[model samples]
Target: MAVPEGEISDALQVLRRVFGYDAFREGQGEIIEHVVAGNDALVLMPTGGGKSLCYQIPALVRKGVGVVISPLIALMQDQVDALRNAGVRAGFLNSTQDLDERRVVEAQFVAGELDLLYLAPERLKVASTVQLLDRGDIALFAIDEAHCVAQWGHDFRPDYLLLSGLHERWPDVPRIALTATATQATRTEIASRLNLEQARHFVASFDRPNIQYRIEPKNEPKRQLLHLLRTEHSGDAGIVYCLSRNSVEKIAEFLTANGIEAVPYHAGLDPRTRAENQSRFLREDGLVVVATIAFGMGIDKPDVRFVAHLDLPKSVEGYYQETGRAGRDGLPSTAWLAYGLNDVVNLRKMIDTSEGDAAHRRRLSVHLDAMLALCETVECRRVQLLNYFGQDGEPCGNCDTCLTPPESWDGTIAAQKLLSAIVRLDRERRQKFGAGHVIDILTGKKNAKVIQFDHDALSVFGVGSELRDTEWRGVVRQLLAQGLLAVESNYGALVLTDTSPEVLKGARKVMLRREPEPTKAAKAAKTAKERKAPVDLPSEAMPVFERLRTWRAAQAKDQGVPAYVIFHDATLREIATAMPSSLTELGKISGVGENKLAKYGNQVLETLTPA
Candidate 1:
């Protein structure tokens, strides 16, 4: 579809006045043009890739109101607020609003005053709501985080299953499904669930050049996390993801106690608290959020400096999508993950006990296996991760492997020693203690746990002490990362998997990177206060930048949507620096789509050089 003739110029005004972006990102123009021309689309964009403009601008430029189905009430509200602040007529109907507020939004919809309306899937199921939607002329039906409609997704939502009704209800309306991560299976499932099998597909490359990916074997995860925060991410806007709610609280407390400005977020917190924490993270600068997987889905923060995982994520997709949240502004960011045998065991246990059909279990297992390979691979982690999504690539040359290659050694004997111990322990009691105690028994140390188990009397005892504790730990981590050993599900006990027998029988040789020795002096050389990134953008840019930022804030608030949903900071900086004057000139800026050009182009032009 071609750019809407005059609409381009108008949307650009909204873009400038509300978002301060002089133009759209690379492909956003084509996406908006396609949608504005009335066609279904599937947008596979990286986080911070300006996917929202694919629909947001079109919704504004086209005649009637835009209907957006989003999963998170908080995120929807944020987006709506941001939009309203920009002077667009936007509102959302979700659980957070009272009946009166909902009634007001409904009236606005009926009166044709709303430019866009965000709704939760569950609310859309109500007969009254369905009837109301039937009465309105929906410019487009946008499914945000469309991957959630697919059961195969990490963040699947059953309510998303009801979205198929859109095709049946409004066959003529254009529908757009957007997500940060979607593999082949996930893409298929999304189309199936949302009844968009025929939608035009736009799959952007998954690479986030700004992010440096690293996977370190879990060694005192808290300490390593603290080290990274102190060295690379101090006083930066970042998120630390844990596998559990309790861990989120503990990590937040620890970071806060250590003088970092951080907050905890999880479903376990009160709704008000969750909202408060989210607000703090978004509105305040340089705040870290220690959260469970429950956070960051649909969050539109553009300046996240890093995303650290305290435990291994269940799948590479989950990790990719989460890490993509960082560096949205096109600035450099980092993806740091710490994993251990315990994390692997826990993840396996969760999958094994998950409620699903046989096919589902098998599919999930495949994803887990891929995740394990990613954690264990000594090559570029980014290469292996992208390959799983069917994208082949050379080394990123920016990750830990490309920067510092670790020494890897044949771990065949050590693997045999560990597996032999598990076999002798009868598998039932294997997981009772940690790898250290198991290593002690294999190396013939008379520790209390080993002595109580009488493991010192076995033939495997004292068979392997040549490796130091650090070396043995490395082997254990590699075995876990390779899926050769698992702490029995639920009990945290060690158990040998089928792969363990292969390693023990010499059918498989394990290669593991040797652990680096710690230098006490090096560790103590710098404190948390010394580790923050230098934010050195031009001082001239700061003042107009703040004005542009304030305009964006008001626009976002008035529109009732997250700020980035309007225009990313990268676009804002381009607007500030390039100072484009006309629609033709503005179109050259990244992220200014045809619809965006029509609605926001003039506003940005006016902001840069007021009439």
Candidate 2:
């Protein structure tokens, strides 16, 4: 079933007339070509890398409806809505739809009225659903968020494990599995589990240079978050991720109290309330979502200005995927985090106490260690992140490290002192203690526990008095990150690993990063300037942008959809900058597809016209 030459021309027309893009982004054309040729593909593209177009254009060019297996029901609706708005015949069937609605969509699919159909994986398990799908002509099977199939991934869905049935049932249909985040391990698991082992793999660059990475020590984290919102990301849409439901509620309340429009979202809330909060965050401009890990998968919002983490994430892959949600429109965005040693201890305790075999626990430990390394790395954050996914990149100047280089000092003595304290406490007292106790002993702080245990007279006691309390904490954190120190899972006790002996014997030299100074006024000013509207519209065009936004908001409200569904801020900025006077001129601008131009052309022109 090779695509005819004329159909290729039709695909290009759909790209321009329907999708409003003149040319294909990098790797999109290749993937589309392969799919149109009825080949399987495994695409590992970054967030905001235009992955939808890879399967979308090919679906239009081919003869049958494209069946996209999405994980989330909400995501399916969002995609279907966007496609319908673009004038594509797209529909979705999920649990949310009633039998009548499902039958209507099924009739449309059977009648060849739909260009694309979205389905949750669970639907494929039903005999009736399978019979319905079997009766239709499926163009290809496109698996969105393919990484969910990996058992080790953070967002693994039990339903995704059933996706392999697609290949077994419809061997003739070309399949394309796509995800925004996947490491080498996760990629292999996705390919193997989804029966895409023979599929051609396309691994795009994992770097998102538009996002500026910054990690600060947790000191009055709420105040720090407020400063970030007020000073850097004023009047912008963003997400705040906490580790617990209580924290999400409190933070959301705190933000709202401070005059910032914020909403809370977590699994603990009523489903309707969570849905409403998510809807508000999506529909309203400048509304922040304070949520836990339960939120933020498959979100299509493109103008999020920042993603702030109130606590440390579980793994590097998780951190990368979460932070990658920001600056998705290729605008300068920030990924700010406030973390301290408590995050490490808490995460370790979680891993240790969780039900798992030794092997499973070991894998979890490795993932956490990688995340901690990223947080503690003195080198380029982007480089470290990319390297974790098996990509090589130079220092990205946008990250905090490259912006303000931190001084590194040889911490061999500091390491020996800490290891010595751990070993002496264990051997002499037959007791294991956490970092705080070790630091107390090292800095000559004879608290009641130390005096009670007679640890005030240890040989290593007071040996590390030269370094401050914060500095010692840094050393211990780095040691844990480097695997020289391990936290016991059950009791949260710190223990030495095999690597600790090397540092204790002076065979290995340790380097620790000096904590960066507080954010200065000059730096804040520079960041504020950088966080302005991404478009380069002239000063005179500012009013036009505002007017366009107002019109878009009205349209979105009328349609009960997110404003970006009508037109993204980037598209509006383009329209304002270009100031196209005619429908033809408006269609020439990117993102103004033929359907949109026909639908809103007159309104846009009237808005642009002089009063």
Residue range 151-211, candidate 2, lDDT tens digits: 6777888888888889889999999999988889999999999999999999999999788
Model 2 — which ten-residue stretch has the worst lDDT? 519-528
What is the clash count for each candidate, in the order shown?
Answer: 66, 0
lDDT of 1 by residue, 1-611 (tens): 55557776766665665455677777787777788888899999988888887888889888899999999788877787667645678999998889999999999998899999999999977999999998888899999999888878888888998889898989989999999999998999898888888888888788887688877767788898898888777678999999899899899999999989899999999999999899878876689999998898887788998999998888888989889888888787878888876777677778778898889878788888888788777688778878888888889766766555556788888788888777776754443556777788766799887778777787778887787776677777678777788766566667778778788778887887764345522332232123224444476766666667777777666654556656777777777777776899887776665556776777777777644
Per-candidate local distance difference test: 0.80, 0.88
lDDT score of residue 136 within candidate 1 = 86
Badly placed stretches (over 4 Å) of model 2 are 1-3, 519-528, 531-534
Candidate 1 ranges with C-alpha deviation above 4 Å: 1-23, 427-434, 515-535, 539-611
Give me candidate 2's TM-score against the actual structure. 0.96
Q: Each candidate's TM vs. the true structure?
A: 0.86, 0.96
Native-referenced Cα lDDT, model 1: 0.80
